[model samples]
Target: MNFGPPLTTRETPAQRAQGELILGFKRLGAVTKIDTLFQQGALKARLPRPQDPTLCEAVTLNISGGVAGGDALDTMVTLAPGAQLALASQAAERIYRTPGPAARIRTRLIVQEGARLDYLPQETILFDRFALDRELDIDLQGDAEFVGVETLLFGRQAMGEIVQSGSLRDRIRLRHDGRLVFQDATRLEGGIAAQLQRRTVADGARAVAGLIIAGPEAAHKLDSLRAVLNAAPGIVAGASAFDNMIFARLLAPDGASLRQCLISALEACRERRKLPRVWQG
Candidate 1:
């Protein structure tokens, strides 16, 4: 029972034998330009129905055949000074079961001075034997602000399966004015989930998401942020300021909870930074 309409289809069999879809967006001064680029696509995608669509917008990328190794989706988003943009996926990104290949998605975001970028995509779930490679890069000016949250689920819980198979190679990099600020390169393989839960990365949590907020006032709002996170239920989260950036982390059991926590955290930061409440439904 797929609750909604059949997850929007992409292309026909004859047309999809090529590669997957690729959606792209570029923003300049509050306006967005989209390019639905596909390797060999035939089906069309529709708009997402988000709980609070006004806060975020989604444009279909490429929808070709099923995901496979060497398949890639490249996107570039640029913001002008004094402009702001919020972006999210239409739905939880799904990685279908594949034999030996992996789906790859690369996203690059650029925030100019005095501009802001908020990217809150839904969770990414990997089915058994599924392989995926994801890369996210952010380039920021000293005064630019950026917020991005990504949640990864190991396996399909409903099927009573665990993430014992396949591999995920994930990378994250953030730079400010040509200086490296933060970088994380991690690989998850056999029995890695158990190790991740022991004491380090995520502590065995089924879902995890990170929020990065950078701007002028990020350093002054640490105390208030602590209080807000303390109020969330069944959540282990933290906030800190470094190199003119304020970042937060939240670990939970699933994607919905993480998104709620993200909304709360964003609201707290907005209040302290005197920015508008962009998550309001």
Candidate 2:
């Protein structure tokens, strides 16, 4: 009944875990639909019936349960002209300790003219000794709208876990009309918990997150977005706008605080529309 590797074998590198998912959405007349979907290994995408017929919502499932060292996962998404879609996950992703190499995750997103895409995946939990390398790239063509969210937790506060040591490399790149407009990266290694505890670093926060809204209307909404974040407690948050984009980052004591602030702040970016129903669960 024990499906995992035995204690003796756990120390060895886990090389068999790999997953990939590719999805495409397009608008035909008045409706947005999934035009292409491909799944390999342990990654799958599911589309739910939406209240708004013009929008496509997809929730991805990870059959492998969690990511381990030496694991490789890749995801790519595309939205054609005039299409609207929101991409989210069923639950938080967990990256476990790896005695061997680091786990790698690569993601690419493409949005054509007049299209709208919301990237709202859940949090990623980093466990002690975990080694992970992740990157995300977004390509926007013409006038497109995009809202993205990324949250990271050092460990689960409810589970009383502590990430005393680990390594992580995270990067993000954004391009508009084939020109790169935004880039960000985060790298942490060795004594992760201690490094984050520094006052100049994270101020002992256990969770960190970033939200971005890019479109013609993005910069104009900065004031309203910051207003929502100002009232949030148990967190330190700030927002900035440039080149028709609104970027905000937050550090919180736990996941609960981060989620609460996001719910309200995201509403401003979404034009008052609620987030994906899956996020509620």
Worst 10 residues of 2 by lDDT: 7-16
CA lDDT, every model vs. true structure: 0.65, 0.91
Q: What TM-score does prediction 1 earn?
A: 0.74
* Candidate 1 lDDT trough over 10 residues, lowest sum: 13-22
Per-residue lDDT of 233-252 in model 1, one digit per residue for the tens? 88888877888777777787
Alpha-carbon shift of residue 165 in model 1 (angstroms): 2.5
The best candidate by TM-score is 2
Superposition TM-score, candidate 2 onto the true structure = 0.94
Clashing pairs in 1: 10-43, 11-43, 21-62, 21-63, 22-62, 23-61, 69-102, 197-204
CA-RMSD of model 2:
5.1
Prediction 1 global C-alpha lDDT: 0.65
Root-mean-square deviation per candidate: 9.4, 5.1
Q: For candidate 2, write residues 141-228 as lDDT tens digits.
A: 8889999999999999999999999999999999999888999899999999899999887999999999999998899889999888
